[model samples]
Target: MSSRSVIIDNTDAQVQYSPGWQANGSPNEYKRTTSNTETQGASFTLKFVGTSVAVYGTLDIVTLPNTTYVLDGGNPFPFSGQPQSQIQYQQVFYTSPSLPYGEHTLVGSCVDGGGRVILDYFVVEIPLEIPTNTSLSTPTSAVPTTLGSKPTPPTTAIVGGVLGGLLFLMTILVAYLWYRQFRDPGRRRDTKPSFTSAEQDAQTRPFNAPAMASSSYITTQHDAETPNHYSETPRHRDVISTVERHKSPHVSLQWNQSQQPPSYSM
Candidate 1:
């Protein structure tokens, strides 16, 4: 990021000094060339690479005239010399703003009414180290290392697969149910009950009733006022009736009829 000055001798510039111009100074000196010609077109062009450029020359208010400075084919600017009795060498007459970092040309011309134009040298302000395509070394601590040979699959794909499988199973179950409904519309209504008829009757039967009964007898009398005695009592009769009403084919019942028995002795 440091900057340095590049000095170009006036002898190295492309000088177009017309007749009456003098080249009297030494080539190694700062002000190597001088032109006192009053011609309007006496000029010098210098090419250099830098961010900015300045022209170094002798300025004299009594001898030098107003000079024109043109940069990169742009508009020219007039530089009026200050009133001074003595010639000053290495004086910065004009300087340009920071230009692009590349080659550029600057032109200095003397006006017709000007007295003299001295070409001392040129100064170019440039960076000390110009950047190039060379590669820079990176610290090992700043670089990252590979942790594995292959990258793992994303969790979203695995989750999507599980969800897809569950959806497929649900679709199949729903399709099966729809098919069953279409094939047998009344299957739900016709389904067998969990309990059988015998089991239902047993559940409804009285808890104290006998599950089975042996042979039983009954007698009927024509006289309503007289009471008829049977082998089984009235309570046993009621149990027998209940068993006969709800009896299944597995159980057997026998009945006997007889006239009123002879008067029972107390």
Candidate 2:
């Protein structure tokens, strides 16, 4: 960076004047040089960090005035009086030589003369802020060696992504299970449809049979052998009666003269 100069007003906290010195509001910049008993032995001090510093002031009473500047509490140097015309208002009263690039204290004091001093401001000169380059051929700490390793990402990000993926998968699994549970009962309740009587008559069997012919033959034989005049009441025959009829195939008839033909009416 470049060097620069800054103007610090007398009202800045860094400027410390002895007690009983005049302090008008901060807007104006004059530390009064003379009060009733403050004309002589009056001192103002300021600390700053820079290459050099210069104190500027206005001369209200420079007639036979005596002042001195002390830097870093070192030997004092007297303020040189200006020739011909008395300097006033924002004039450099004393300036320190180019000093070190660190903090230094500058003190201005009115020694003997009763002349008044008005400290307007102080200027501090800062030197260039360039940094020097340093060589580092060796590492201070050991580093690990891997043949082919990918750069590691942040732990928080990787963890978050994994957790998010797992959560999404869990949500899908729950939804799938819930859907199966909702659908399975309806599937189990499914039943085959019932057929009507008319539909059953329209159906066909796989095997062939002569059921109609057999039933018709049996019916014809029973009708021809039966007489209508015979008692039509239903009868139950005993087993003995069937066996006796099977035993007698013929019956011998003994006819006597007394046995006339029985009269029959048809």
Candidate 3:
């Protein structure tokens, strides 16, 4: 689907030069190195892998002569001679015809002994094609499928249940305390003391003692009548007795009684 070119340096090629030929310089330049041979049969050979291959070198018309090139045991083809005084480096010297894509070889020989030839590099063009499936059947091995595990429930529900039970217990305890505070009679303090039946009767009954007349009553009675003939009326004595009882702290009077007054004798 695609094509690309590759450059091979002169150092990568094979050189067979006679003792009379001279070699110089490195492969980084367009004119990597020069080789001069006064002897014929001096040759340069290059082996490469690609669909097409071309040779590159220097051409000097003043001091260089023509050369011959052959491709894969084919017939020799002579390179064109430069008549004018010109010098060129990294020039395409020869290109082979398009051959099948594989390993190929090219060889160059000095046609004239006096000629100078420079070996620089070679350019190879390669065709790239997308690979296709050669087999028709599918693979028999199966790919394993991974199954996901189910998620587990969290512990929050259990913790919440425990907290809810504690809250219910606390609520019941608070309610019980409230009920006890209002309903328990023993917890209340008495503001008034309770009395016994005998104490109540003693407090309610009056002192039963004979009444003593006041000095004013005695004086009034003496002025009214002689001491020996002073007859005390029962109603008058009762009135005096009531007055005296009210004044005395030891006596108790009852106003609800409807009884006959007692008769007094002087």
Task: Give me the displacement of residue 125 in model 3, in angstroms.
Answer: 1.2
Candidate 1 local lDDT, 84-162, one digit each (tens): 7766655778889987566778877877754777666566666656656423322222212122111122367679999
* Candidate 2 colliding pairs: none
The stretch of ten residues in a row with the least summed lDDT in candidate 3 is 142-151
Better of 2 and 3 by TM-score: 3
Give per-model TM-scores: 0.44, 0.42, 0.43
Better of 1 and 3 by TM-score: 1
lDDT of each: 0.61, 0.57, 0.61
Judged by whole-model lDDT over C-alpha atoms, candidate 3 comes out at 0.61
Q: What is the lDDT of residue 161 in candidate 3?
A: 100
Question: What TM value does model 1 have?
Answer: 0.44
Candidate 1 runs further than 4 Å off: 13-20, 26-36, 133-266
Model 1: how far residue 61 lies from native, Å: 5.0
Ranking of candidates on TM-score, top first: 1, 3, 2
